[model samples]
Target chain A: MKTLLMTISRDLKVAYRNPADVINPLVFFVIVISLFPLGISPSADVLVGIAPGVIWVAALLSCLLSFELMFRSDYEDGSLEQMTFGSGPFILVIMGKIVSHWIMTGLPLALLSPLLGMMLFVPPPGLTALMLSLLLATPTLSLLGSVGAGLTVGLRKGGVLVAILVLPLFVPVLILATAMVQTGIQGGDYTGHMLWLGALLAIATGISPLATSAAVRISLSH
Target chain B: MLNVRNLTCIRDERVLFENLSFSLGAGEALRVEGSNGTGKTTLLRILAGLYEDYEGEVDWALDEFPLYVGHKPGVKDLLTATENLTWLSALQEGQVAPDAVRAALAQVNLRGFEDVSCGSMSEGQRKRVNLARLYLTRASAWILDEPFSAIDVSGIAALEERMNDHVLAGGLLLLITHQQLQLDCAVRSLRLGV
Candidate 1:
């Protein structure tokens, strides 16, 4: 737990020191969210109806955009190698990275979802549900995205490849999160969708870190 | 103390080395001398427990892990020299005192550059930053792959002196270097011919 916290703190420090890293994803989220209103129907009702999916998709893409930067920089600089050979298990190191990634990218996206959703004309009640569902679901995104990030850490042009590899895995989260918001908007009980989101988060948290460590080991071997 | 017997390494369908055997007792130094492409780095990796494709038995009589420093200095370009050392110290399970880190950097003639981003430093300077890490960790064994590739003459002498001190303090050193290193110690040289 101490090593995990240290890794997370190191990552957070790195993230905070680099302004462009934080701003790029936030800008991407805003720009992607803004496009929906201009490209889709101008009717407020139609825009509000589609806001949940739009916000979720934007958040997913933003998270995916930041995932490549998670392990690649450390791997290239040899910190990843040090962690692998260090006292702690590599999976624990990976878990720390995932937690830091959530704190930096996922948590910020969750916090900003309401404003992004509002831009799409999402009503207040649905915006609340969207934020709640994203809060539960984005850590799962960070965890699963880390596996792809680890697998492609050493490859040239790994960023686009990571997006291609991880975005498909996010479909269930996207569907369930948006469904929860839509159900809330329709005055229906959203407990079932929230429950499914929680299950996905649980499963992802349980399995992805170990898989990511294996993938990182393989990548380093080559 | 460290022991390795029957170590083999294979890379890219080519056997780099096979049936390699060596051991180092406390306060002993082993220098791996080899031509280019002779698998010195790969052997170092195997010894450092980073590569497991080889068949070998390794035993150590120490509580600390062996420190491996590869050709790359492993310092992040964006981080200041101090931050780099701090993160490395944390990863290695050592408490890195700022004063100690600063002293190490000054010993390497990198004073006043601790707050500078490593990307701005010269190649020799970057190598110095990596050498400073040796002063920060208390690992019993050091596996250094090409530790003197781009360092200046003065830096090389300082590094040799540091290695000599480490050996004097009952530390084991496994170094892969192309250039000849002058040191006063019980040195064992292993040459790999391709």
Candidate 2:
């Protein structure tokens, strides 16, 4: 637990020191959302209809943007090597990283959903579903993205490759999270949609760190 | 103690080294010498358990785990020197007191640079920060790759002295370096790509 917490504190410390890293994805999230209403239509009916899909997609992309550097610096500077060879199970440090990644990118984005939902003209119920769905889905995003990031840590233009690898996996979450908001907008029960997202999260949390460790071991092999 | 038998590594379909074997007991130092791209770093990674695609039997018996420092210093640019050491040592499950960390920094001639961000330090100073970790490590074996490549004469001498002390204290080390380490202990040299 100490190793896990130290990794969390260290990852967050590094992220906190770099202002651009913390702010860029968030700015991207807001900019993408604001541009949707302008590019498509200013009509509230159209905006409200497309808002959940647009918001969820934007959040996924922003999370991916931050995920690119999750293991890059550590790999480049040999921290990953040391972390792998360290005393305790290195998998725990990886688990710590996933948590910190969520705290940095996922938590803030979820907090901002209310404001983003307002701009999208989403109703109160939809906004509630939006926040809850984001809260559930972002952990999965961070987890799945970590696997992609670990696989492409050494590749040139790895960010694009990670997106390509992870987007397919994200499809189910997108479908289910957007379905939650849509159901809420129509005053229908959305509990089923959330349960689906929760199941995805549970599976993702169980498997991603181990897959990432294997991918990292592959990349480390000469 | 560290033992390796019949280790062969092939990288990118090219054989870097094969039929390699060596061992080091407590308080002994083995210096791995090789040309660039000759798998000096690869050999260290394999021993460190970071690489798995090798034909070998590595039987290592020790109390604390091995501390592996590679070509890179593993220091984060945004973190200060003290923060980096604290966390790095924490990886070993050794909570060296703050005063002890300060003393380690002083031992490495980095006394006044603890609070400074590692990004702003000179190359030698950065190397010094990594060497300071030596004072904080509690591992039974040290696996260092190219530990003497980018440092000053005095820094190298300090490092050699530390190695001698470690050996005299019955620690084990497997180091890779082109520069000869003059230590007053049992020294073994192994060349790769033969």
| Candidate topping TM-score | 2
- Tell me model 1's lDDT, rounded to 2 decimals: 0.85
Reference-based TM-score of each model: 0.95, 0.97
Deviation (Å) of A110 in candidate 1: 1.1
RMSD of candidate 2 to the truth, in angstroms, is: 1.3
Per-residue C-alpha lDDT of model 1 across residues A149-211, encoded as one tens digit per residue: 999998988988998899899999988998899987777788898889999999998999989
Which lDDT tens digits does candidate 1 get at residues B147-191? 888888888998999999999899999998877789898899988
Residue range A31-93, candidate 2, lDDT tens digits: 999999889998999999999999999999999899888899988877777787566787888
Q: Which CAPRI quality tier does the interface of model 2 achieve?
A: medium
Tell me the DockQ of each model, to 2 decimals: 0.57, 0.75
Pairs that collide in candidate 1 are: none
The window of 10 residues in a row where model 1 chain A has the poorest summed lDDT is A81-90
Q: Note each model's CA RMSD in angstroms.
A: 1.8, 1.3
Best by lDDT: 2
